[model samples]
Target: MSDSRGAAMSDGRTATKGLAFHRLSAPSVLALARGEGGGAAVEELLTAERSRRLLLVRALADSLGEGDPPHPAGTAPMAHRAAWTLLARTQQRAPRVFENILMSPQTGMWLSLALRRLRGATAYEDAPLWVVAGHLSALAAAVGARAGLDFSLTVPVRHGRVPLPTLGCAVFADAAEPWGTAQVDAREGRLRITAGRETVTAGPEWSRSAPGWHAVRRLELEPTGPGKVLLLDELDPYRTFPHPSPPRLLSADEARTWQELLTGAWEILRRDEPQSTEAMRVGLMSLAPTPARERYRPHSVTAGDAFGGVMASRPDDVAQLAATLVHEFQHTKLGGLIHLGPLSEPSAPPGAPEQLFYAPWRDDPRPLGGLLQGIYAFAGVARFWSVHRHAADAAYAPMAHFEFALWRAQVSSTVDLVHRHDRLTALGRRLLGTLRERCEEWMAEPVPPAELALAQEVAADHRARWRAHHLRPPAAAVQDAVEAWRRGDARPPAALAAPPELAPVADTRYLDTAAVLARYRLGAPAADPSDIEGVTAADLLLARGDLSGAREAFVTQLAGKETASDAWAGLGRALAGATEHRDASRLLRHHPERARAVQSALEHATGRGADPVELATWLGLGPGETDLD
Candidate 1:
């Protein structure tokens, strides 16, 4: 990592953005963003970022000329013309030069494109582009750079539509691998590109597609029949030079499975989400199978770009495949939109709380922005199941219904939280409004009462477990509360202190819904529901409200020793429900979310003393019941 304090750091490599992978010292970036400590710091940035900083200077000065643009994200990356057209919205609250140039859409776009400039980036955090952009934008304000003007950065930085036109041509690379040297030509409409000994070709029509958006600036693909595919997974050198994990070429069986999965995804989108189908084809170019795991599982992930993609294993069914494909694509859409506009508070305004809140879906607490992103993606998942439910079997349809109801509600609450923020740009508000409307529309769709209950229970359980794992009460307040309880005070304090700081759950266990679905489809009994680490396992126990059992499950992890974080949360819940209120209160104080979840479970959970077996049955866990703690 560069010191970022004195000199602009360089590794002899350059990115697309004029600035190299440079990180302005943390204090420097933070100070600039807050518009703190005058000219000296600004001068340093000007020295480091130099001419490259000018791009941001033009982009921001143009889009936000003294006014906040209406459609910050939608405005595209321009300063001069964009500023003129966006004049209506920027009239008030328009940022003057050197203001808190925080979360500007054009600024974000410039930064993202610039960040992409880093080739085979080994250590990305060393010089984060976002912070660099913030510093540069600040420098522009300090130097007073304006739109349509020539500018330069002394620092050196070096630096795709769906269904690309198909052509027939043989490709060759001068080097051993077709990375920097690869070339493609389609003289008569066939396409080929050589990588190592392999050459991927399209005979006049590169019609194959790998299945997968939003106001996502829809990209219309040339009607080349179907989806597009990227033959080469290892875009950079293959010897693990750049990315964290290299791509694994699929085995023949895996390839066939993938092709089938793609076909299934295409059908689903063609029927309900045509926009998504196009986005998948036009945006995503590469598909690489996830590395082998000890257990059979399906996984899908994508970096913010529309290009690279990953899948873990062949799913027992295509529906499972479709859900993850759509989920990550929504993230891609959101990433793109964020570049175009700010969806939530991008950074803390000194004196404003930088508090992280519990998200039901994650083991760790997330910033509001992170929470918003997950909810939006899951809400999209809900929409997916809305259609998929009808296509599912009797045993599986209920699960689909539950998924829709649960995520829609979750997204609605998240959107509501985001909506209340006064700092949201007009475009951000519009996007959230649309999302809210969509969530509300789908949430009202009918589902079987029993299944809806199941969905609510799972959602509620996860939230409780998350709270237990994360939320904490203030230490001083907790001490006072402990004292009061010791004195046998019947009254709960008016307002308690902030939650205690606890370590966050690093990587939580993922739910094996696909496994559950497979068992259901085969008319086979579900094996015992293992206590999963993270949100899902805790969810299974907490859903039943077996307070003591949950505590035991956590403290002992009967199945296996799990994370201490989970144990503390489980113990907190069990203790809270018992007469020994001190331990419970302390635990709850440490895990405010856990406390809240428990309270909610008690309020909504039906049938007290429900056998563990019956409770598990109700929760679709097993035919056999197991008690809570």
Candidate 2:
């Protein structure tokens, strides 16, 4: 390696531009934060991220010397074939601060998983293999090396923290084993790692011993079913990290409840989807309780690709557990697929936040990849429920059936848009084909006519809202049309294009039970003032032909101190329904949702729809409807 480095230096082919990595003084960084408490934390995070990235730079320089990616092997063994694929194609450039290693989205997740799997599979038993989790330590290290920040496996865990992997986190470790153990004493806020002949502990400057090492208590996984099942409580992420809000530890009775849920869900998966069960057994190994605030969500998340551990809030709905498992495991699976090959090529630009499609599952507009993930996840969920729904009780069965039909149609339509996309590689195309097959099979499954109608309405309402938000006619054209209509001119303008609308200000898109069965099953979990569920409910009310109820709900939701965008959009539809089709351009022309409502209301007002003059008076758009005559 030294000879190679010397040779590269001689030939001027070395990656070492030898730029010194600058470290920002803590005091200086804090001073820049202006004494604002949260700002200080932000500064600290930035410092840590920068410092860790510098370490990666050092590591990369040491590893590669000068050769291109897929260069000669080093100290530790790696799943080099798949792991190095991205490296070979990676564009080389001078290492700069604040720049992330070139990776597709979630590539970090896969690298961590690959390391974990590699560590588990290797037979060397001399020393315990360390699983490096946190993205800062693992991903940055992997990608940095790819970019020529060449160093060996072991990395610095910033702030004197142990590189303990997060639950269900993807992790990394050196191919070569460290000479000694790193003893961590969280109770005393101390870390001692002895790699080779070097031994170091945290100094005073290092705070809290490690990045997230807060717990003095060891979270033991108590084996239930005499080692077949595990009941875990202490593994909560809050316990590990300095959390703003830590969840209260579950009592023995609470653990019992969790155990029951896990056992039941496992049974369902083990029977219905054996592959999912096996994948989960291999990937998802530990469970951590989440804070209450996370309830009504998907109920679970893995830190990265390290599937051996997961954190989730206890669920009110047991059926949701299996569904969550399937959903998250798909992410893990996708991560592996990513490591294996590029699903999406390097060409067409990734979708920006505004251009993303609004998925039914999330309040925010998701990038195309995110939408693809959503549809793929749902496909798995649909498959699970397709077989399992029949065995469920009355309320659960209908909800499951609704879920199956919804995802079936949603995935089908979504695939059509993505199928011919230039970004998809051959492997990506093949995956989509399989998903389409599953969708077809599930779409054929029987759903009650009424349930199906309800599902369709929810689907249509969201799509229409998305369309109204994103897909718009040109503003000039719309203005021309409006003016022409005002002038009693017949011809309409050509087109209006609008940017896609994401949900307003952090809406909690709770994973609620199917709206069709919510009344009989899960009750309304309160959402913040900005959530779109109210608007969704209002739409459902309209679909039921309960015009007054829909009006009242929309108005009530809109009555918030600030009118949410969704509420305004629903109000437009509600006003149109209530007035029997008129004008809702009364207020909110500044926003697109409201403008569309106005247009929709006005468009339907004429031709046996409603008395335009009366609607104008009722809606307060004007003394009377636009005088188009």
Candidate 1 at 403: error in angstroms? Answer: 1.7
TM-score of each predicted structure versus truth: 0.54, 0.56
lDDT of 2 by residue, 206-248 (tens): 3222332332222322234323333253422222211212224
Candidate 1 per-residue C-alpha lDDT over 344-413 given as tens digits, one digit per residue, 9 for 90 to 100: 5556677775657666566577776787678767766777888888877787676677666766777777
The TM-score of candidate 1 is 0.54
lDDT of each: 0.43, 0.44
Which portions of model 2 show Cα errors greater than 4 Å? 1-249, 293-296, 349-355, 468-472, 488-545, 552-563, 568-594, 597-629
Number of clashing pairs per prediction, in order: 47, 26
